[model samples]
Target chain A: MLRVLIFSIFASSAAFAAESGGMPQLDPNSWVPQIFWLIITFGGLYIVISKIVFPRLSESIEQRNDYVSDLVDEAKTLAEQTEKLNNEYKELISNSKKEAQEIITNGRKKLNAEFDKKKNELDKNISELTEKAEKEIQSFKSNSIKDVQTIASQVSGELLKELSLNDEIDQNIIIKKIEDISKKKMGELN
Target chain B: MANPMNQFEVKTIGPKIEIGNFDISFSNASLFMVITVATISLLFIFATKKKSLVPSRLQLLAEMAYEFVAKMISETAGSKARPYFPFILTLFLFVLFCNMIGMIPYSFTVTSHIIVTFALAIFIFIGVTIIGFVKHGFGYLKLFVPSGVPVVLLPIIVVIEVISYLSRPVSLSVRLFANMMAGHTMMKVFGGFVISLGLVGGWLPLGFSVALTGLEILVAFLQAYVFAILTCIYLNDALNLHH
Candidate 1:
């Protein structure tokens, strides 16, 4: 299609130029200056594009990607560290609680043992005092009994002296006196 | 009959300026190039300003253009050349726009001029050369000689490779300029035929014009793609210095 177009254009242009008695205007040589100018312009453009512009744009994109990834990694690391620290704190709290519970149990056991020891010592002291008191009471009772018997015998003797002038008339009365004396002795013993 | 080819004739926009040895004629072609540059800049700026997650129509168009060139560069020059996406994209759009604009009535096609196309080609040539030296230093000369050639055939292979390498700019420039110039000239001739034929007989030329328009549009896109792809190939040589 393009070739046909070119041929038709050339054929028509040539016919028209010849009919007008003018020189052919679209000769190849006429384009020499234009070609040189194109080379100069395109040369400069290509240099700027490849060397400076393209490199800078690519660098910017790479830098941006790196920055984003770095940010994400930093955030992930921080989150992990925080989680680790939290676990450490939880363990510390649990260990301290267990230690506290052990201390309280040990203190209660020591207190109960001391209380039992003091109660046993008090009971032994009380028993010894009771035994000594019982012995003293027994001795006092025997002494009192002996004193009463002696007093009774002395009184009987004095009575007999006073009654000596009338004694031959009543022998039976004497016997009765002896019996009363014995009875008095038994009462004093009781 | 009015000559359609007359539209392409270079007309002076302002007086010619001569500053010492410099002779400058600012023509309609230059004016249109300036317009094209301005239009491209404005369009991109507007399109990308409010970049959305789900793109607006304008942003979609802009992103599509970017993705298109990016894919092309990666495909042709490998992923290493993805960095050159913006430059390649700009070149393709600018050239593509210039060609399409020239197809419009009374519009001057800057790319049709040999000077414009050659300029682009030479820019690629010089740039690739510089990259080769910078990347491989003196070893860049090895690009002209393959590594695995037999000793007897080495010189012949090297000569052929060198000739092929040197002809890159010529072919690149000629391809673009020839395509644009020929397409536009033909369109002009057919347009002239339509005008000369009365309304009763003008339908044939009209139908041809429509078909030609569609084909020209396709050619415009293809030429820009070819130009950019060739640049990538040249860049690859510079970067890798492969035979």
Candidate 2:
């Protein structure tokens, strides 16, 4: 069996080591195999790692780094765009507010001017109508006073005629006297 | 009871194979090396299979390892060491996996062996040296001659510098091998005590073994880190030729 052979080999080697009275590492018989295997295994490892493992790891790491930086760049650009939009929005709002305020002020100024003009026109019309009415009343009062004096003098003449006293008085005198009396009565009333 | 050294003993796993005078038969050490290599390769391959933007845990692990070694190279050796990233990553992962695998009960620790670590360190030393020559020509020899030393002290200083430079591989290899070997051996020794002390007295050694296992795991990671960083430092010296 391989086990027995392995055991025998171990036993023989152990005895040989004992006979040599030294460490097995110092044993010359084992050095060749150890070095040979070391060269083979280390060489193989170096090749596999350099050719395969290292490249893959570095590639993935590089990929992750690139992805992260790209994300950051995208986020930065997006943030910048958002800020630009925000500034535009703010400017638009302020412009509109200014325009609205200007419109309101202009409208108020126009309305105030129109109101002042209309009020002045109405005041002038009212004063002109009042003056016309006052003139008409004054004219009517003077004419009515004249008519009353004429009627009084005519009635007096008729009464005098009926009484046969009008022929004794002068028509001119009667008219003059009525005029004087009316003048005096009017002055007193005034 | 088994000898604690028996765990370190190199044993043939399959039928012996010979090429000329060399007995380069498959061994437990070899098996573990294959396992370490296989595990690392598979884990990474699987981890990066999706390569998704959002990483899974396995992918995160693979990336962390990549980043750790990448940072180590960039920091210690600078950008000039970029070409050597794979080598450093492989070295770090290999030693790390080997140490970690060894922590598992009954698993072989490839890095615990001196020949294995010495092989790696010597390879790095030779490779870095060759890189230095290739990059800087013979001017790389100026590494041994300090710039600030006076003419009289230059000889002594250069000698010291040369000796230190030569000892880089030895120190690098020995540091890792000794830390791993000592930690594993100590754990094994305590483990032996736990078994021999019986149920009533074994709790103490058991506790120590548990604590030691934790420390050994930390040492395993630290040793791997130290090994990789030192290699980076060496690479830096060779590339930059800094005093």
Candidate 3:
């Protein structure tokens, strides 16, 4: 390969530098060239690495870290949002249940109040009618009793007139006797 | 037969250039260093061209190098070394390539030279000391004073600390230079033995050479890692003044 040939050319030329006085590394003469090349090569490498290579590598790493952190932040925000929505839904369900219980209780109370009011009104009317019926019955019984007493007295007097022995009887006594007879007949009929 | 040690000898690759009496001619070490830099540059350029998040093979390698250096810096120096990441990463890659390329048969190890290693270590030392002074002003001198040392031992401890601090460049450069040079020398010695032993007995020393090569490869990587990590630690000490 062309690359290998070029390498060999440089290699052969450099190897030829090994044939002089002592260990070339320790020789005073060789230090100059080594130092010269060192300055050029090392200095150039330093400039290149510091100015260009390192920064790019560091930037790439930073960019990757930033991308990962951004994803984490987004995921955390979405999780928080979901939690908020879930809490709201829970509150809604609980509120609806509370409202339903209140409605049932109100309906039951209203229905019971209406039923009690109608029953009380019917009770008052029934009591009044019963009292009136009792009073009317009492008045009718008193009138009938008085009339029976009077009629009994009159019949008794006519019978006594027809009979000669009744002339000796007192008026008061006759009335009392008629009343007693009517009382006896009332007791037997009751 | 050519002496095995002759491989370590220095020679000029081309026409000599002179600058004010300085003999800075083109040489093997320079060539290898140039090769290392070029390869490193091409690798990064190719690896990063696509910029794909899902990495290709080269991209993965590039990314690994980036992360490896970054992690090492953060671990040893903390995040304050963020700005110095490129410098440290460059040093690691360069030294790593230098060590690895030297493992090739008949190739020069640029890092094997004492002068080169010392130059790098001295650069690191001077830079770190400057940073320490800039950050802490005169307070940087307090690095030698241990916080909890008994008063009796304070003088001795401070002396020790100061010596160690001053010896940073020497220790750093010598450690890397010695490791690489010793490994390569040992391999060469065993290679010589294999040749001298001929086919019948070469197998035993050859096996040793193989094992030593593998070990040397591992050492090459480790030494570079250690070198960079120590640099980071020194940088940390300066940046934070955590002596």
Candidate number of the best TM-score: 2
| The best candidate in terms of lDDT | 2
- DockQ, all candidates in order: 0.08, 0.36, 0.20
| Stretch of 10 with least lDDT, candidate 1 chain A | A21-30
Error of 2 at B214 (Å): 1.1
Q: Give the DockQ of candidate 1.
A: 0.08
Q: In model 2, what lDDT does residue A93 have?
A: 100
Across A1-190, the per-residue lDDT of candidate 3 in tens digits comes to: 5346334533443353455344556567677777877887899988777776777666666666787899999999999999999999999999999999999999999999998998898998898898898888898789778767766676576556644666677778777766766666667555
| TM-score per candidate, chains pooled | 0.62, 0.85, 0.71
Error of 3 at B196 (Å): 2.6
lDDT of the structure predicted as candidate 2: 0.88
- Between which residue pairs do clashes occur in model 1? A34-B115, A38-B118, A38-B119, A39-B118, A39-B119, A42-B119, A42-B123, A43-B123
Docking class of 3: incorrect
Clashes of 2: 0
> Candidate 1 chain B: worst 10 consecutive residues by lDDT?
B17-26
**lDDT tens string, model 1, A40-121?**
4444444544554344434444555587899899999999999999999999999999999999999899888888888777
Model 3: residues with Cα > 4 Å off, grouped in runs: A1-23, A81-190
DockQ of 3: 0.20
**Interface RMSD, model 2, angstroms:** 5.6
Higher-DockQ candidate among 2 and 3? 2
